[model samples]
Target chain A: MNRDFAIECERLSRIYRSGSIPGRGRETPALTDLTMQVPKAVVFGLLGPNGAGKTTTIRILSTLLAPTSGSARVLGYDVVKQAKQVRERIGFILGGDRGLYGRLTGKQNVRYFGALNRLNPKTAKRRGDELLERVGLAAAADTLVEEYSRGMKQRLHIARGLLTDPEVIFMDEPTIGLDPMGAQELRQYIPELVGQGKTILLTTHYMLEADMLCDEIALIDHGRLVALGTPDEIKRNFSRLTIFEIVVNQTSETLTAELSNIDGVQHVETSAEGIFQKITIAVEAGVDARDQIQATIGAERVESLVVRDPTLEEAYVSILT
Target chain B: MAAALHNIALQAYYSYKGLFLWLNWTAYISNVFIAPVVFVVIVTLTGRFAGQSDSANAYIIGMAAYAIPAILSGGILQSFCYERTFGTLSLIYASRSNRWVTYWSKGLLHYPNGLLAAATSLLFGWLLLDLDFSRLNWPALVVLLLVISFSCLCLCLFVGNFSIALREWIIPVGITNGLLLITSGVVVPVDQLPGFLGEIGRVVPLTHGLSALREAFEGASLGDLVDDIVYELVVGLCYLLAGGFLFSLLEANAKRTGTYESAI
Candidate 1:
């Protein structure tokens, strides 16, 4: 384990056995032996589809559930043996827009959790004010939390997470229920926290959010890490071929066969819209198929062409499966 | 220690504040006033209808006098029960506050309010029911109420052990409240029961409590029932100590087994 690593795990796993009935016994494994590390002072995104064990990992790290086997640590403290210390070092905001006291004012709710973190009354009060201001909730400080919109509540939840000034924070789907504007506000705050040297562990399904905010990502599937690296790195490494779409004359079949026969042409497909056909051809970057394609199909047959780098979604779809 | 106490108290207050916003304060506020008044009124109504040997005023005073203990018992137990059932028990057990500090703060919260309600009930009964306290035994009365309250407070400490281990509080709440009412002789005098049932009542904390209450206002001195009063006090103390030890044992087991959160 790196000494500077903010989090480390060695074959961490969890198996939630079903409670035994009078005559039957059964069990299910929620997490496999997954090993990964999150370095200090950076945003590490845990990306996965729903039911892919992303939340389970967060739950174990947060000390909300005991791991069935192996070991894990957050901020150098053993999750089980030093839960109190770990709790002090890491604040968690769970997904699904829960974790708020809807009846209390936002300021009061923050103070309550601050108290739970053992902050002094005066200090808790001060932290509450500072956090409210930090999250742009100062104006709605005294208003009941129930009255706040979903976006506002999410902002308050983020503010609550910062109340303890933890060294590392976990945000699970922080923008799950927010509109574009609310997501924009939360997205804007991530960089500021990163600038302050706070190590953030964020989990989100939105690839754009991950690509925009996270310095690194570990893509999880079926309780396994399928890919792990920087966003750009994953996209570059997974993108085997560049795709080009050509709108040509309806008789583009002859051109398709010739393009397929080219040295680096990997695959070709076409869609017909009435009499016109839009042909898509993928070729390896090192070889040029344009000459062969135009030579066989003719200049008139090739009306227009578009070539672009692969998107993160395309890369993810190609790698995960 | 003070830091922990302040934190726990603030957290409890915030929970109550949250409850208030949801119109859930009925349960808490009733502990201070409504429950105690009900006890006093029940005793008074029973006394009038039955024309019992004791004056209606005396019955009211006796019942009202036990209000402090009743309130303490009701407050601690009710608070524990409600918090546990509502999924907020985590607020107490996992709190940054020390166990003893949290225990005492919760125990003391009901005393002042309970005593006030008791005093008010007694004043009302004395003025309207024409009961005489001129011959009342003040020292005996004070000791009786204190002992009774202490017993219930001790019971609270024990009930808390179960609450911590098993968060489904309905069973504990129903059992505790029902046991207190039946055994305390609050509804019917213990002497009226026959044989073993009556014998069981004699050993109950409420029997001793009610006996002391009646004796005090009837001008009976501590010297008159010295042995019984002493016995009740000793039994109450034993329950307190024994319950505390058992609670500590259960709490240790709960933490180790990681069963506290799964109890509900």
Candidate 2:
């Protein structure tokens, strides 16, 4: 309930139960003793794989689901007792086409959500028109939404989410079905919303997107927080592991086995690059076995080699796995 | 107060428009317009064949009145349950809308459509059955029909909310429509059933309204039909209150169980 925090949860947990019989029914724990705080204005990414409690957490913060235990607050309001207050200060966009009405025109869909958010007629119209233009949908605004492309539908969803001009926004898989260009445009849009001092909590499965967009990230797996930090900081956690990228005209099992036998080497992956084969070697930080690897492979066969730090994605995989 | 009413009105209009699969053009026309005529003609002719020609007018009036529930049962259910199908119902639950306003609006515009269906049914009755409307009190019949169709809407929402909360979506509407058809003096008089069923019919909407319609058609004055009119209105009011209670109750259960987010 801290005023400084736009979104806060203390030991928030949720367990979903099925079937009519209470004790006899099966229980699935979706979130377990999770705790985090999001500051007033930043894109806070909830990074996770699938079935990793990301949606459950987002739904709880959005006031769409009640926690089985613990507590969550949005803008200093308790989610259960002050749900209306939370709802008033927040707008959320779901990932796919499910939440929108297919028969309504894009403007009509926007107006409907605007009204749901209790916007007056003038404000709803003005803002709806503005957002449609912002999302590059003004030309198609009058068309029925079902006739729009998937990317267009996603843009309409974004317009609806911003209709309320909320203080905190929650988006689940916001770029789920967008094309590369569409996703890139949305990536630019996220920062502008944050620049307006609105806190955004977005769940994402894309490691690169999280690295590029998030001000702070909390990585979760199996309903627990596995890691939390800036992209650089998280990647620095695995800085002690160095990656060696090698290219050669050819590669064989003998070379791979020889590379594996190196004292501090961890993994060797090989893939084709046109007529050449690219070999990647991950080894411990201090073990700079450049000579041993070069001598083992014969210097004439080794075309080139480069050493670099593990990327955010590689660090994420190493930490989680 | 004004804003709340606006929300209700917008919700009513948009929900009805949004929930339509449009029913396909021909299917909707036949169901709402053509089928009522066939129902009235067949039932009225059957009464004549049974040597009960005296019941022909009664059958025509009952079948016409039935057009409201027939349309509303599907109409109300579609609008009420549509959010779940599209996975958008949770959007309202998650928003800053008043519970009463949101749920009440789901049943709002539907009854107006019910009134139109009943009119079509009666128009067919007037044309095909040669049912006489010369002495019928037109104003009194319109008013009674409005109240009766509204009451049927209240009853439909009541059953839809309570049963959907229990995860029974389709069955309750089916059962309620059949029960009303049998017990509301449609096709057969309620008094012909068991004593308890007759008492049941006395309170359900449309039973008393249809009775008043009969008296009005027989040249009875509006003042003389006050007893049936009052009883019909009272039944409607009761269902209206009950439907609100059940909707609030359904919302509470859904929130507690954390099942309010999606229809699936």
State the lDDT at B13 in candidate 2. Answer: 75
Off by over 4 Å in 1: A20-23, A236-310, A315-320, B1-5, B19-39, B47-113, B120-132, B137-171, B188-211, B219-264
C-alpha lDDT (0 to 100) for residue B142 of candidate 2? 84
Chain B TM-score (each prediction, in order): 0.73, 0.92
**TM-score attained by model 2:** 0.93
Candidate 1 C-alpha error for residue B18, in Å:
2.9
DockQ, all models = 0.28, 0.57
TM-score of each: 0.76, 0.93
Question: lDDT of model 1 at residue B248?
Answer: 49
Tens-place lDDT digits, model 2, residues B1-264? 676567567777777777755456786787777877788889899999999887888999998888888778776776666676677777777777777777667778777767877888788888887788989998788888887898888888777674455444567768887888888999778889899888888878889888888878888887888888888888988988998898777666677677754721
Worst 10 residues of 2 chain A by lDDT: A233-242
DockQ for candidate 1, please give it.
Answer: 0.28
**lDDT of model 1, residue A5:** 86
Q: How large is the interface RMSD of candidate 1? A: 4.7
Instruction: Please write out the lDDT profile of model 1 over residues A137-158, one tens digit for every residue.
Output: 8999999888988778878878
